[model samples]
Target chain A: MTTSPNSYADKAAEVAARATPERLVVRVRALSDRAIAWLFIAPTIVLLLAINIFPLFWAIYLSFTNFRANRPNAEVKHVGLDNYTRVLNDPDIWVSMQTTAHFVFWTILLQTLIGFALAYLIDRKFRGHAFWTTLILIPMMLSPAVVGNFWRFLYEPQIGLFAYAVSFLTGIPTSEIQMLGSVNLAPWAIIIVDTWMWTPYVMLICLAGLRSIPDYIYEAAEVDRASNWRQFWSITVPMALPFIMLAVLFRGIENFKMFDMVNLLTGGGPGSTTEVASITLKRDAFEAWATGRSSAFAIVLFVAVFGLANIYVKALNRVKQR
Target chain B: MADVTLKGMTKSFGKGGAKRAVDGIDLHIADGEFVVLLGPTGAGKTTTLRLIAGIETPDAGTVSIGGRPMAGLAPASRDVAFVFQQYSLYPHLTVYENLAFPLRSPARRMDAATIDARVREVAKMVRIDHKLESRSTRLSGGEMQRVAIGRALVRRPSIYLMDEPLSSLDAKLRGELRLELKRIQKDLGATLLYVTHDQIEAMTMADRIGILAEGRLVQIGTPREIYADPANLHVAARLGQPHINLLPAGLLPGVEMPPGTKTIGARTEHIAIAREEGGNARIDWIEHLGDQNHLHIKLGEQKLVTLADPDMAVAPGDPISLSLKNPLYFGRDGQRLV
Candidate 1:
């Protein structure tokens, strides 16, 4: 049988001519734009509500009750403010808080100074600078677990490169330098490892800030007869302050809840000398299985970080505005 | 104030030093004079300013400020204030602090009261005193440039070097700032070397205009001398509105013939035209510029544009006789033939 080429379109046209406006409206194939947009986005919203928002509210609810993960079949009671008061009054928690504060303070201070210095040197565009930059970034590129394990090996008193080097420098025995084993040096040992692993990240951010400055400003400063020292304080430091602050913000939040590296390296070692807040939270939640009290402690931490970060961000904005 | 001098200064850039950014150039600017180097982009106008400011080390020769040879001297020690093409103000500082920065150098060791006084004086001069406390990044383009110029003015250096400081502003603001800069220069009697490609800027503000091309100094003179008696075809093309027109040596009918004359340069003053039935040139178009009109005429295959009054009896396609009256002549080598 022979078929005409326009037969299909002709039949469709005949159906369209016979249809009424109401029938045409009923035959519409696609939903409105708003409905289509929601259709595409619904899965992501539902998943986020289930995984993120639900857990957050659930944790808040658990913080007010006496619930134990190990004793789930036992009676659960809504013991209002009891878990919060017990966590707050615990002396062990206070010790962990002080250790965390010390670690954060020293690590931030050392990383900023060393990172800025390295960034300044790299900004000079010296020979082999690209090679050096890549070499310096190797530590930051590795997984934190790898870095922690590696540094832990280096901290060993026997047959370790770091202990031997320190011994050689100070003319002392390698066995005397027990970094992770001794109470006095355990906190410092963690600080040193964290600085080594993360200083490159801070340097990268500062390098970006340095490169963003146009060359003409320096030329202008030179023509204005500004001394090199003056230019460093007046032009270089002030211009890079905002980026430095941003790096601090990121590192601050990350280190507040820092866990993997510290756990692998020291594990709150040498009689709780290096136990940070996150280690305390992990012990309470997983080891002792105190779900309700641990959840209360986690809420307190979240508020502290959120509150401090908000204040820091406001200061950063003020600096940028200048 | 000091007399600035460049003795056979030369500079080159690129790998293996192949591209000559500034060729051998000898120039002198007497004390309290305003000299402008006019050239198109890549003509080495900015390089010359940088060389004088000691920002770039020349491959040969020397730059002298106040008869002191400046070789191996740092830019900061050279004592020449430079205004960059872009307003390179310190973004983290207020306008007042930016102006006070040059005074705060350890070498200067200026007292706080004196620094404050100078900053306020310059802020008022540039007409940006109202926004002294605002950050330099917060101002508009023109206001930023004003602050930059004011920063340079706060220092009393040997000479001032500006690299197209007004080129970034709009036409209206450029005109206003040009007048203000000239007035400020005259008032201070500062020895200044300003570089730009704008002919109007050079003509109106320069005590002497230097024409540069292909990294070479082609000619240097007062605006009128450069216009009336250009040394070469390049210098003649550097100045004047509607530009000097070039025609075949015998294309027009008014000048006495000189031997080896390959081309004739004609401005509006040299060209004379009259309406005739069978004239040599035909009016191609008339561009009305309000105060004056640009009359584009066709002489066989060659086209020339000249300024004309708006009320002139001419229109597109009108036949008119065109001839030269004491027009400039150039040899085959592009050198001027007197």
Candidate 2:
């Protein structure tokens, strides 16, 4: 074959002969562009309706009735807003909501500040910056369950590196640093772990914002006689604010529904001190079998998150407009 | 106001400083003078401006502003205003804030009322007062450029350095802004150094023009002198609109060349054309440009374009006798022969 003089020509002719331009009866209808687009998206819409929309409406319907998953054959009574009222008045549920709020607030605040600082330092483009960035991103790359379990050992009083370091810093005994056991320190412990794991995600977004700013703008600022401090406050902060806010929004939503990490770490605490709303929801739906009340609680949480996110997105848009 | 002086200024980049972005060049910009550095891309014009503005440090020379050596001085301390080629206005700031930025600096410590008044004044000067409240990012290219210029103008800096500030605009906007800039500079009587590749901008605006080529200042003089008495072929080719015609020596009659004249630089003003039956040149084509006609001529395998009147009695293939009148002459080294 290698010695054949017209091998390429023969192959070309053979392939050309095989490629018969055949005409067959076409069955596809001439759909308008709008129809074609809808056709292409129909399956995704149907799947979303079946799995997401149907479940959502079903949860809403179930919230209105006193239905118990354990007693499936029992007659479900229509409870007119009774579950909502109960959820609103329940002190334990209130405490869980407060805990969720605290976690969201502290984690977002700490993550934003630390993440923005880290992004600023990385934007300096120093030597070993690539290695440092990769190292910083390791926490975000790990599974939340792994991160939670990993931090659980670190929060241990006797052998934990974190407890030992804190004890050494403050001259306190390592045995007294009951991070997971103490009511006061358990929330802080979870916050620390979450901030450690998710701060890199925020930093990545902020780094994008910082890098989007052209070098000429800084040069122009310098020529305008702005000091480095002034430039950071005026140019750097304002330009990167939208990205920072986006990171906050993401972490705020994710941490609100946080179950796996907290469940893995302390299982809602040494006495429900770290009992976020999701853990309460899980206990109500599965352990207590109060499906109606839990559904109401889930709907309330959904509405609160959706409303807050909508307001936050509007504010983010305002910042971006600036 | 300050006079800028550069002595043996040199800058280079890359390892071991192999690529010289700016070579050794000496220049002096008198106080209240407008100097335009005209060059093609990568000719070190912007680098020269950056070096003077202290955005870049010289590698082997000194830059002194107001007779004070600017060594180790930061750009913010140099008292120079630079308008970048792209409008580098703060996207988060409005037109008014952009204008007020320099005044709000802690170093300036301008009062709020005074800053507001100055911002408005500069905005009005640049004809952007109507859009003062609009975000800088929301502006069109022309409006943004106006805001950028206004931002530079708000401060009473010692020198203004602009790097192709009008190049980003369309032709009409560039023309309007060019006139406005000249007027504003005249009103302020401030020292300004402008760099552009557009010949018309340099020729029309500069009190003195400096031709830069390959990181060297090839020639520096009044625009008229630079256009009429270029030091070399490069400087001669830098200023003309239709471009100066470089022809082999003795291509045309009626001009006395100095000894060793290897090239003749014939612009529209230097060339004399007359219609004839058996002429030495033939009109290849006449490009109609509304106001004036560009006559492309062919003479013995050589082609040259010269500007002619729109109603000139000539068409393609018309034979014409061409002569040179005190045209510029250059030697084999491309250096002008007086």
Individual DockQ of the candidates? 0.69, 0.67
Per-residue CA lDDT of model 2 for A1-322, tens digit only, reads 2647588789886686566443311222336577789989999999999999999999999999999999999999999899999999999999999999999999999999999999999999999999999999999999998898888899889899999999999999999999999999999889988999999999999999999989999999998888889999999999989999999999999999999999988889879999999999999999999999999999999999999999999999999887
Task: Encode model 1's per-residue lDDT on A93-131: one tens digit a residue.
Answer: 999999999999889999999999999999999999999
Clashes of 2: 0
DockQ class, candidate 1: medium
Each model's lDDT comes to 0.93, 0.92
Off by over 4 Å in 1: A1-44, B253-255
Candidate that scores best on DockQ: 1
Output the number of the TM-score-best candidate.
1
* TM value for model 1: 0.94
Instruction: Report residue A53 deviation for candidate 2 (angstroms).
Output: 1.5
True lDDT of residue B231, candidate 1? 98
